[model samples]
Target: MNDDMRRLVRVQEIMVVIDALQEKIASNPAEVARLEKDLLAAQKDADADRARVSELSKDRRRLEMDLMGIESKISKYQSQLLEVKTNKEYQAMLHEIETCKTERAALDEKILLEMEESEKRSAALRSMEEMLERKRRETSQGKTRLDAEAQDLMRQVGALESERTEIMAGIAPAYLQPFIKVARQRKGLALVAVRDERCGGCHVRVMPKLIQQVRRATGLIACDSCKRFLYVPDEPSRAAGAGAESPAQ
Candidate 1:
């Protein structure tokens, strides 16, 4: 192909790479958001476990206080039994003492159950906290890696853009302007190789005359169907023949 066509092809190739890198950069934010969401869910689970443990502890304390109050009542009733003046009064005092003891026993059972539950919940909380810590570390590392990758992608795009600029400088305006217009209209694909007598962009067959003109590489040629610049790739055998002839010259 001619020098101008070669430069155009190089610019298109560079643009394709830049577009892919930019696409990856654009998707980074969504990936970061997903990481944050997982970490947040873990945090919420740990917080809920901590709250449940606290509630169990509070219940245990309340049950213990009730048990103490019942013990105090029983102690007062027992002391009065010694001063009773009649059998009926003494029996009544004994009954009151028995009722207090029963109440105290029920309170003790409740307190024991509460303590057991609190211990179980506390253990679960510890496990949850450890998991939360792991998630935090993983999230931090993931975000850091993503950030580094984004920065590297940006650098690659910058370098490719610089190369594209240098290639564009060597192309004439007459060719560059139409290429830019077509590339804009065709999603940055203004140039395509003609293969098997077909337009690579549109996959439509080209006339013999147009195919001949493209093979000659004499001027800018466009596919009739897609309006994209078309070029014939140098065949290996033809390139070899040209090389052999050039040595004679």
Candidate 2:
């Protein structure tokens, strides 16, 4: 390749790197968002579990208070039975005492059930909290790693931009403009090699005359199909040069 071709190739190489780096930088935010969303879900689940445990605790406490009140009432009724003036009143007080005892027993059973449920909920809450903490740590680490990677990619892009500028400075404006225009349209490939009578950029066959012009490298030789500037490799050109003195078969 001649000097211009070399410069163009260098520019394309730098652009490819720059494009990749820019794409990574653009995608960094989405990655961070996904991590944050995962962490948020974990936190919400932990909070819900904790709330359930709290509610069960309140129920257990209320049941305990109710049992204490029922016991006090039963004691009062039994003491009143001792002072009853007739068997009927004594029987009525006895019935009231039995009802209070039954209510206390029910409260005891309810308290036991509440305690069992609270235990289960507490265990679940602990598990959720641990999971949430792990998720938080993972999210934080992921964010840090992603941010560092994005910063590094940005730095690489900056360096590539500097290199591209220097390479572009060596080429004439007329040649550089067309390459830039085509590269923008073709995704960073402005020049292509002509191989096997085909345009490398579009993979379309080229005319014999176009291939000969590319071989000479005497002027800009664009592929008729893809409009990409075509060049023949230096090895083949040199080989052709070496055999130029041989008589044509």
Candidate 3:
């Protein structure tokens, strides 16, 4: 290959590297959003568990108050027994005392049940809290890992831009606009190889004469089907170059 074709090959390699870097950069927002969604779910679950435990606590308190009121009525009935004068009055007081005792028994049962439920709820809430905490820790760790990945990708983008600037300086000005236009259309893949006597970009078999001319690396050649610049690889590009899909024989 001569001087001009060699420059196009180098430009193509730089463009491929830039493509991979851009792809990495483009995915960062989605990755961060996925992590945030997980954390949000964990937080929502924790809040629901907390509200359930609070409701149980309120129910337990209400039951305790009911039990206390029953006990007070029993005390008042017992005191009224002492103040009774006739047998009828005494009998009436006894009836009142029995009714209070029945009400007190029912209240005691309700209190016991509420207490048991509250205990179970409290335990479940504690477990949920622990799970939420673990998720928060994992979120922190994921953010750290994502930051490192983003930074690494940023470095690659910077390096690619620098490499692009250096490449732009070396290539002919007349070729730059065409190269940029093709690169934009094909995601940094402006130049394609003539492999197996076909245009790698369009997969249409290049004429044998065109291949022979490209192998000589005389001037830029465009594929009829894809309209992309085509070249025949030299010693170095053939050994190390990786590109898009090529045509079958």
Better of 1 and 3 by TM-score: 1
- Best lDDT goes to which candidate? 1
Evaluation by TM-score, superior candidate among 1 and 2: 1
- TM-scores of the models, in the order given: 0.91, 0.90, 0.86
Candidates' RMSD to native: 3.3, 4.6, 4.6
Model 2 poorest 10 in a row by lDDT: 240-249
How far residue 212's Cα lies from its native spot in candidate 1, in Å, is: 1.0
lDDT digits (tens) for residues 132-249 of candidate 2: 8889999999999999999889888888899889778878777788888988888888898878888888999999987876766655678888888997755744445432332221
What lDDT would each prediction earn against the true structure? Answer: 0.86, 0.82, 0.77
Tens digits of per-residue lDDT for model 1, 1-114? 766777787788899999999999999999999999999999998888899999888888888888889988998999999999999999999999999988988888888888
**Residue 178 in candidate 2, Cα distance off native in Å:** 1.6
Error of 3 at 57 (Å): 1.5
Error of 2 at 126 (Å): 1.0
Ranking by lDDT: 1, 2, 3
